[model samples]
Structure formats: structure tokens, C-alpha cells
Target chain A: MLTVKKASRLFKDGAAGFKNITFTVQKGEIVGILGTSGCGKSTLLRVLSGLDHADSGTIHLNDGSPSGAGVIFQEPRLMPWLSVEDNVLFGFKNPSKYRKQAAHYLSLVGLSEFAGALPRDLSGGMAQRTAIARALASQPSVLLLDEPFSALDAFTKMQLQDLLLDIWQEEKTTMVMVTHDIDEALHVCDRVIVLSGQPGEIAAEFKISQPKPRSRSDLSLATYKEKIFSILEYSNTGLQKYSVR
Target chain B: MKSKLNLIGLGMILPVLLIAIWEAAARLGWIESYLLPAPTVVIESIIEMAQEGTLWAHVSITLYRVGAGFLIGTAAAVFIGAAVGYFKKAEHLLDPILQAFRSIPSLAWVPLFLLWMGIGEPSKVTLIAVGVFFPVYLNIVSGIQGVDRKLIEVGKVYHFNSLQLVRRIILPASLPSFLVGIRSGLGLGWMFVVAAELLGASEGLGYLLVLGQNTSSPELIIASIILFAALGKGTDALLKSIESRSLKWQDNLQNAQ
Candidate 1:
């Protein structure tokens, strides 16, 4: 379990974002933080992953204060210099201990045949998969995803969503994904938090009523998506403040 | 086979035409063997020198100087280039001095070098080394410094070991630049080879030029000039072959996706 309390950030240009944002992700639960393009979604993800310091907030994990947390960014971020297996094995301090596990993860990602291939050889989807594999190799208790699947095509996205569910069910780790796509949020998240525009605050909190491994055809999922969309649409606020740039 | 035959035909056209024209001109007395030796006269002179074992001696001694000087000078330049490129302090410290030295041509050092090193092989080898050194070193340093930082960040996320980062990433990215440097350096080195020989030498093609000058034998001078041209062509071919072989991996890696 991971907790975020009173997270507030103020950028230099008097751009206030994420005001008094507080949330908790229960053990094995996957929560989605949904916002328009520039509601400080990436900043919030960065704060949770310890990549950046929040202005005034506390993020704490249960028991040992978060032994390890793996983060996947918007891009695959694979080193062009390394082979796929070597790249997957990068985080391990002890190569001997992690060798077989790396191979297992390689097969899990369906890249066993390309073990010796370099990152330049992989397609965008494969490269992102390799990045995911690299993160999972750390066996993190809290895994952070910041729009990791946005670049992937629909088919590949579905495949990865399924894989994420499988991995989450098997490992039972806490996950927090920040994304702009409401459909992806409804498809994968256990709960969705809708963030409104500048001086961003949690505008809506929705606990997904649908079951896991959900289909797009599920009525409850559609109900949740429509409900979230109506809330987002009610205010022309997030739209006006969401700058694509 | 068809392409190979086409290449052979392309290769024969210039040499055959030139030889035919030369023979006809000589036969008609339009050109003199004395002032400008015909291809046949030059070939005869080469044969005569070969029979006396002089041509082999001249060529061998010249190769010795070039091989030794190039090996030492290029190696030093590469090491220095890598170091200065990798370290900001060294680059800052050495940049001005290197620039100053670069302004002075290697041939300009000839008179002073004779005074210092006594016109020995050291003086001449030093001349050739200086001529080739700057081009290679400058290119190598630029290549190393020019690698994209974004690509390096990718290496960092993957946790690539430092040596692995340099060997696998840095070097390969910089190779094309380094090869260009070497190509230019080889041509510069060839030009300096004749200059070094002309200064003072007991043997070599350049020494033969001096001998021709002393005896007023334009035939020998033309012969030596041809030999020097041949050596330049041969060395360049060798360097290019090595370049192609070393860079062969790039094609596969770039096209693999």
C-alpha cells in the first residue's frame, strides 16, 4: 500500500497545479489518475515514483518504507547500445541471481527469440514491452506507469492491458497509472480520479463498479465511462485549461 | 559475372587509351623520351632498377619510415583525442596550443629539425607524423564530443556499465567521423612522404628524385614520381578496405529493424 497526502505543486510561472491532492492505493489495487492533457498528471506520477520532489506532500509505503519502486515513462527509454536481454537485466546488481528471471521475463513478453537483438531492431510496441519488462525485473512493490501505453496501437494496447492485469493478479503489487484516455482508464483501473485543469484538484472520484479483465462491451464499464465523461463535460473548465503543448 | 566483366572493361579504358596515345606519340617523334619518357621507357627503367635490386630497396626503406611513423603518430593522436574529448579540463587546456601548432605546416619544421635531429630517419619520420597527426586527432575529438546526450540518457536508464557505454555506444557512434579523419590524414601523410624524402635521405623514391636531379636524369625523376604516386594509391586502397570491413556491422544493425 502507498499513500499520498496533501500533494501540491506550484510551477515558476504562477502556474498552480495539483492542490492538496491526497490519495491511497491499497495493496494489489490498480488506480488510475485521469486528467486532460496538462492537469499535472505526469508531475503527480513523478512525485509518487520519487523521481521528483513534491512541494508539500508525503508519500509513504507500508512496512519498510518502499524497498523498491519501478517506474515506466512515456517513452520506451531503452538503451540503443544493449541487447534486449542485457537491457532487461540492467537493473539487477547481481547478474547470476537475475539471469534465469530475466530469461523468464523475456519469454513472458514474447521476445525470447529476440534476446540477442538490439533495441533498434524492435518495433515501438516491442520496445515499450522491453521497457515494461525492465521495470518488472525489479520486482517492485509499487509500480508507477506514466502514459506508458499511449504510443502503442489499439491491438498492442489491448494485449498489454491484458498482460498488466495478469501480472497484477499474479504479483498483487500496488499500481498507479496516469493517463488522458478515459477508455483506457475504464478498461484497466479499479478506481478513477478525474483531475480538473490549472490549479488542478481532484474533480471526481469514481470506484469502478465493473469486474476485472473487463471488456469494452461491459455496460457497467460504459456506465462508469459516461458518468466520468459527464462530470468532465459539466465544467468547460478542464478543457479550457488543458494545453496540448 | 556480367557486372565483373563490365568493371574490367571500365578499368581497361583509360590505361589502354593513354598507353596507345603515348606509344603513337613516341613513334611519331611528337614526344621525346629524354624530356618526357614514354610509358615503355619508364617501364624499361623500372625493370633495370629491379634487376639491380635498387627499386626493391628504395620502396622497402620508404615503407619502413611510413609504417613506423604512422603507427606511432596515429596511436598517440587517438589516445590524446579520446582523453581530451572525455575530459573538459584537458580539452580547455590543450585547445589553444594544438591550434597554434596546427597553423605551422610540418614542412616548415624541416630546417630546424635537421639542426636538432641531424637529418636522420627520426627527423623525416617526425615530419610525416606531424603532418598526419592533427587531422585524425581533431576528427576523433569532435566525434566523441558530438555524440547525442539523449542517446546517452537511454544508456543510463538501462544501467549500462561505463566501459560498456564507451565501447559499445560512444566508439561506434563516432566511427564514421574517425574514418573520415583517417582518410584525410592518409592523403596528407602521402604528400608529406615525398617532402620528407626530398629533405635528405640515402634511399627511397624521394632519394631517387634527388639522384635524378643531381645527374640531370629527367627519366629517373619521372620514374620516382610514378612510384610515389603508386605507393599513395596503394596505401589509400588499403585504408579504405580496412574501413569498409570495420564498418560492415553498421549496415546490418541499421537495417535489422
Candidate 2:
């Protein structure tokens, strides 16, 4: 439900964050923007979420409005002074009316018992889950997540990926996630877009037709994983090494 | 609970021991009684003042002056601090002047204020306000400016207006520093009162100190000193309770231990 055309951004010192990038996301799709460090993936997400403006080109929502997008950063970014429940209801104009909905979302992220706890008291995984609940509380049409699980342990990361899929199925909200992990992108996304180069542009795109609850060890998924790795390696070597086993 | 009581008892041991030593020294003729009054003598002076109703009257007047000057000073400081913090132009215009004033000791202002406003209630109150103003103002400005930029980004993503950002993020984030400012301001307030009353007043604990020296009564001077110490401790304890309650979300100090 979102379209970004020829979007480009530059730093104040004239270095490119991203240049001439173009992409579109369909309704109810889970898209992963995968790249290595310094690939401008987070910057792209910021542009998409309207927190920062693109230096050139345009971004348009199909419905012609920009009000309904929720963003979660790598850090939970919860107001430490506010309790978990109040944080979830932070942006709501009528918090009392949405109290039930906030509780529901918190329960969805398995933080029902932690509603009164401050952000400092929560574990890393629990704080990230609370952030997820907060984003979902607004019931936005689009949710943008920027390396949200990077700091979490592997077990917690897997659990959050599964939780995210469950929420996606239930809410059917479009999600755009930025990640550096290959398996994580393959595990959670419907489509993966790889970005490369100093001034990043979309290097390649892949569609996964795998069904829900896809197993990581599945034989068929290996080929897709291998293909993605070769594409990444080729991009890294400037297409000098094309061999793929 | 028992451990807490034990801790308090441990704290009292040194003070009690010192008082006992002083009393013994005075009674046994180990020290001159005229220079340092015995504990019993100070207690008798306190009782005498209580009976004559002078103790409560002096206390009330001192409390009134401190309360008025502290409230006025703190309110103005917070306002100016917010303004300077939010606007670069205000900072440029006001910070230099504030820095210059801050370098001058609170006692140094006593003479200038007396000359300007005369040795009345006005000069005394003005001196106390000057002492209270600097710490609170500096802390508030630095606190506001130091708020994390990442948090401000969150506000932008949520579409919060400038007013909402200030109320929700800036003020609460700066609260710890603001509270610190208030505590220090109160301490300086007490010091300024004593300096003000040293010259101008006919009442207050400070006036009693000078009166004791003039009349050669060590008991009155010691009693006044004790009152000042008690009042400072009591107010600081009150502020500490407020700091802990308001910043309950901070687990850093507890977790560190």
C-alpha cells in the first residue's frame, strides 16, 4: 500500500545515505530490506516512516494520507518515566477508550503482567516486546521496524520472529523491516530486497512463495538461501566471482 | 525494619559520644565553661527561651523570610532556565550575565544589597533570593539541553507538537537535575539567611548568634547553631524523599549496588 519513487537522501557533508532508490510494497505484505552495516537501511526506513524527508523524489500512500504509520527503532525508545501500559497508549488522544486495546496488544506480546513495570525493570527481550505492543496499539496501516531484534539473544530473536508472524497473520498490517541477518530475513519475510554499494541502491530482489511456519532446515529453503548468499557475494566482489555450489 | 533501626542507632552513636565528652569536660573543669557551654547549660537556655515564647517567635520570622525568598527565587529561576534552554538567542543574551553573577559569592552581595535596599527586610530577602537563584537556574538549563536527541525523534514520529514534547519529554527528563538544584538552593538559602541576619536583624537564629557574642552568653550562640543544623537536616530529608518518589523508575543506583 506504499510507493517510493526515485527516493534519495544525502548527508550534510555531501555523502550519500542512499541514492535513486525506488520500491513499492503491496498491501498486507511482509518485506525485508536486508543489507550489511552502513547500507542506509535504517535511513530508508526513516524516510518511509516520515521521520526524515527524502532529499529527492516522492513517497505516496495509496490512500493519500500519512497519519497511520508506526515505527519501532533498534532501541525500544520507550519513555522511561512512563509505565509499560502508558507507553503503549502514549500517542492516543483518548487513552481511556484505548486502554482495553493497549492491554490486548500487550497480551499479544506476552507482557500482560508487566503493564505497571517501568522500562528499566524489563529485560532486553521484554522491553522490545513492549515496543512491539506499543506500535501495534495504534493499529496502524504500516509498521516499520529497524533492526529491532539485533540486540536480543538468539532464543529471544526466534521467539520474536514467530510472534511477529502470528501478529502479521492476525492483523494483516503491511510491515517493512530492516535487518542484517540472512536467516532472519529468510525466516520472517515474504519478499527480501538486498541493498549494496557505498551509496546504496537496490542490488537484488527475491520472492519467497514458502508457506507460513516455514522450517529453517527445510531442503527447499536451502536453495533460496544459497541463491541469496551468492548474489550478496557477487555484489561484494563486484561480480568478479560468479561460482555458486 | 530491624536493620534500618540499627543503622539509625549506629548513626547516633558518634554525636551522642561527642556530647557526653563535652559535658564531662565542662563539669570536671577540663575546659573553661565560659568559652564552650555545657550540654545542660544549652538545654537550660532552650527551655528558658521556650518558656518566654521568644524561641517560636524568632523561628516563625526566619521561616517566613526563607519561605518567601526561596519560592520567589526558585520560580523565577525555573522560568528563565526554560527560556534560555529552549532558545539560543535567550542563552546568548542571558548566560554571560548569569555567569558573572554566579561567580560572586552570596555573602559578597550582602553589602551591595544593604547599600541598595538598606538594612531592612527587603535587603535580607533579596540576598537570600540571589543565593537560591543561581544553582537552580544553571541546573535546569543544562538538564534541558542534555535530553537525548533519540527521544526527541520518537516524539516526532508520534506527531507530538512542540508543547507536548516539552511537557511530556523535556520536563520529565530534566526532573532529576531540577530536584538537585532545589536541594542545593535550599542549602544556600539557609547560609544566606545567616549572613543577612548577622548585620540587619533583631530576630532569627543568626541574630541570636550575634546577640550571644555581645552579651557573652555561649549557651545562646550554641543553641542558635544547633537550630540551624537541625533545620538544614530536616529540609534536606524532605527533599530526598521527594527525589526518590519522583524518580522511582531509575534503577541504576540500586542495581549498581
The best candidate by lDDT is: 2
For B1-257, candidate 2 gives per-residue lDDT tens digits of 99999999999999999999999999999989889989999999988999999999888878877878898889999999999997899999999999998898778877788899997888988888888999999899999999888888888888989898898889999998999999999998998889888887999989999999999999999999988889888888999999988988776774354
TM-score of chain A of 1: 0.92
Instruction: DockQ each candidate and list the results.
Output: 0.23, 0.71
lDDT (10s digit) by residue, model 2, range A1-245: 88999998877454447778888999999999988766678899999988899999999877533457888889998889999999998877667788899889999999999999999989999999999998888777789999999999999999999999999888887999999988988888989998876467898898988987688787877887888787677666763353341
**TM-score (C-alpha, index-matched) for candidate 2:** 0.95
Best by DockQ: 2
Structure candidate 2, residue pairs in collision:
none
lDDT of 1 by residue, A142-206 (tens): 77899989988989988888888887777776789999889889988998999876667898899
**lDDT tens digits by residue: candidate 1, B194-248:** 8989888899998999998898777799889889888988998988887776664
| Native-interface RMSD of candidate 2 | 1.1
Query: Candidate 2 chain A: worst 10 consecutive residues by lDDT?
Result: A236-245
- In every candidate, what fraction of the native interface contacts is reproduced? 0.10, 0.74
